[model samples]
Target: MSMRFGSRRQGRLAGAGVLAAATAGAALVAAPTAHAASVHVVTPGQSIQQAVDASRPGDIVQIMPGTYQESVLVNVPRLTIQGAGAQRVILKPPAAATAQGGAPKASTPDTPSTAGAASTPDTPSTADNAADVTPATTANPCFTTGTGICVAGTEGHRLKGVRIQGLTVTGFATYGVAATETDHLVVAGVNASGNKLYGIGEQKSVRAVFVRNHAADNGEAGIFLANTTQEEAGALDLDGARVSGNVLTGNTMGVVLRRVRDMDVLRNSVTGNCAGMFVIGDENTPRGGDLTIRDNEVSANTKYCAPNSHLPFVQGAGIVLTGVENTVVERNRIEGNVGTSQMSGGVVLFKSFVGVPNTGNTVRDNMLSGNAPADLADRDTAGKDNTFTGNSCSISQPAGRC
Candidate 1:
């Protein structure tokens, strides 16, 4: 079944203003300071944390090529932390620290689940919900928090204009990189792998960007964004947050955007995992939606994952959206994914665990092949105003959708 999707020129044209505003916001964050910013360089064997601590707002902390052992934290605003390159600069746990293994899981205030709802044996609670290592120190909270790098801010004083780039962070117990209550944050050209949970994660943040990065071999989602991991809450407006030009593989899921709105997931290569992408929402105020998933290559996500409290075992799922409204999925290349789970498909609209159905979503112009169950699966019969048109696929659930 081959059908031509209608032109989206009007939508693109209407969104130009929003894109411009987001670009301007990013520029303002990256603009040069009135006074020259200081640069602190750290070589191998030096304490990166010390350098970071010494830095003031708008300062640059440059890490030289070498393997370093220490967790770094950035709380100051307008700070730039850069490395020589992802290959040359590596951050791991301290030598005395024991290596933590197995997949990382997340426990809500009321219920427990793995990151993005995929799990395996020996899973530990995620950084946000888990207790810190013994003898946790206030001077460097990240040291015992099991996070390689953490940008932390309270709701009253959000961290703003922090940039992290060109580094490799791996082998941590929880997230390789994490941020909370942040604004105008940027993570670019980094490699985060071998972590127990998310490679990179952000919660309660807005106007964030993740670009040109590689995330692999993580136990959970390579990149995860959410409103709050600690408790159930309403979705947050992301102010045009974006995930683009990244390679995500060998994780439970490539990317998970949970309870967030006004975001873009574009031009990503996702494969070799249980699922490629998940857009999850629930019965809450300002339900997650108004996002775009476009121009991505998703394929061959055949890794098996065990069932969690929220979801059944998921494999070969390209993109799954639940309880979201007004979301657009278009112009993606999805193929070679095969599984029997209800969520498995090239593009699936599934019912939310809380019984909320998808609403006003669109799936169009995606090329799909070799997907089991069905390429286009509208599993949410109760969903409202969901449309499937202009797709190039041979099979779809309930027939005639392709």
Candidate 2:
């Protein structure tokens, strides 16, 4: 497992834990989710940032067809930002969003590829190159970190029915979706590609949902949901989140879920994406509740998705964990995920956990190939106290116990 690095840099404890909503629907769990609210329309000149600034809580901000060059920052809480269609509302900055501040720096040098390019032939190999492709997409194509598609901040944000489909989000400075100190976020039908930091950076966010999204050709990782915030004890800070029906490729990791609790990751496709799914806790913080990873297709992350990406000594894994507890890894197909780091196991449980040893987790009924199991069981786990049994490569990782 990687050493749990965050944007915080060389030093600092990453964050807190994930608080999941109870398992099952309303009948199975208490406190059901409310229905989505009504829609509000937006137009040109009326940029999304202005509307978000003007919108009241519980109101919706719907975007219309146009290239919204303005770098939008949403601080309002409990408001929805819906796009008419991915093709209609074109978000991003001209001349690179981050480059738009005042005048050009003049002396700044053009960096190499910010997003991963097809250099190493992994699989489904193609003879034609990036230059030959029609309507070519620029590498690291973000409008700019501060001036790209939808940069939402604060709490209770929602992005739905978006048509950010056909547009290319590239040449940005920061993150695609830089969500911090936020909750109840919903992002769907978005094609987030060619970003600087992360395609979607869900930092210190809670109760978020990412569905029907496509992320590719970005630097760093795709979908980075980290529990960087701490709630009161017994309150369960971040809880009951889900990532489903999405395509993650050509990024450091398909979906990196860290410090989340009681969440279910299901029905997603991670291919040609580096490190299909990464789960773990920070070095000494050592706390996150049950995570259920099931029923997904994970393959080829090494060839296309990651190709040659590496962070210092850590290579990558299809499903990797470091000091995580009370989790389930099952029903997922893991095949043909290749990595350079010799220790890149299909499923890895790093060194030992902090605080107490990681316990009460199960790994069963998971298919594996191109990679073998890292360890038969978690080294930090106490035998019998933590069940270790029933896993099939052809079946599901959580078929029984681990």
Candidate 3:
């Protein structure tokens, strides 16, 4: 009996020892690692891409005052790229001579190739000649065509919390700024101009804000938001975008939203483009929900025809809503949208061949004047559900009085 009792006691002690060993191992495995944030200052002669490559998440890349002839691609989360000032910090493509050969000519002192890795701000940087082998064209496939700044993400790898501030991005081959499948992004106080395509392009992205920026002289729209679809369900995720307090001019369209939802376009000055704004719906991607356009100064957008562009020339229009539903246009100063075409007007609504009608749209209490032919027009066959009320305009089409 004594031997049996001693064996039981030893057995219980062995079980307790095993459990304590397991607990100790778990505590070691679950220990947290330290993540330190870093600040990398990029001077005139340092390569921003090299700085980005050395950075982890939650790092700041500060660009000093100079012209950087390079395209940047940012895929890291919680990353901040700040410049000294918009006009002082210029990010442009390499000169055509440098871009063609993918090497610096050694004649230009400011080439991006001569720019080395990151250094302190007190250390003056050499000019760098940029190459295409870096992160320049490494955006999403939908946004790979652009050359300025591309912020993108892939499946299972979502990037968020990015801020781009106080930079002048210009003279690129395509879009000045392209954000694809990203979220919580902010593009503020930047001047994006003279690109071959959109000044700022957001595709399949959500919760993006564009404020206090200037977009001009782009080959396409100043600001474009589209939902280019993939085979998966919910692939086109264009939602919760706010475009306010910006100046859009000298593009094909100032602002264009296709298949976007819950958009607010307010307090913007859109002028001197092909069309001030366009909300289009088509068969592949249907129109989205709850668009509000108010308190904008939309004028003088009569340059509707351009070469090598596919947008139909809709003459003399401040805003055009086609095949859209549940939209509101109010309190805008729309004037001087004059053209010889019969379809030209201050605010026009039309239908497309997509079979979805423009229903439940409200055009009310807008200040309109000097618009040629009319101040408002409804050319949709299924335009019965739309309401036009309390508009302060001289002339309206389809025999309406407001």
Off by over 4 Å in 2: 1-40, 44-46, 94-170, 229-236, 283-286, 304-310, 313-316, 352-358, 372-388, 394-402
Instruction: Indicate the worst ten consecutive residues by lDDT in candidate 3.
Output: 108-117
Model 1: residues >4 Å from true position, as ranges?
1-34, 99-144
**Which residue pairs collide, candidate 1?**
none
TM-score for candidate 3, please give it: 0.78
Q: Provide the lowest-lDDT 10-residue window in model 2.
A: 13-22
Cα TM-score of candidate 1 = 0.85
1 versus 3: better TM-score goes to: 1
> Tens digits of per-residue lDDT for model 2 on 250-366?
777787765567788887878776577776553333455478989888876664332233232334467765546778888787776655553355665543323334456676777
Please name the candidate that would achieve the greatest TM-score relative to the true structure.
Answer: 1
**TM-score of each model, in listed order:** 0.85, 0.65, 0.78
List per-prediction Cα lDDT, in the order shown.
Answer: 0.78, 0.51, 0.67
Q: What's model 2's overall lDDT?
A: 0.51
Query: Model 3 Cα displacement at 223 (Å)?
Result: 0.5
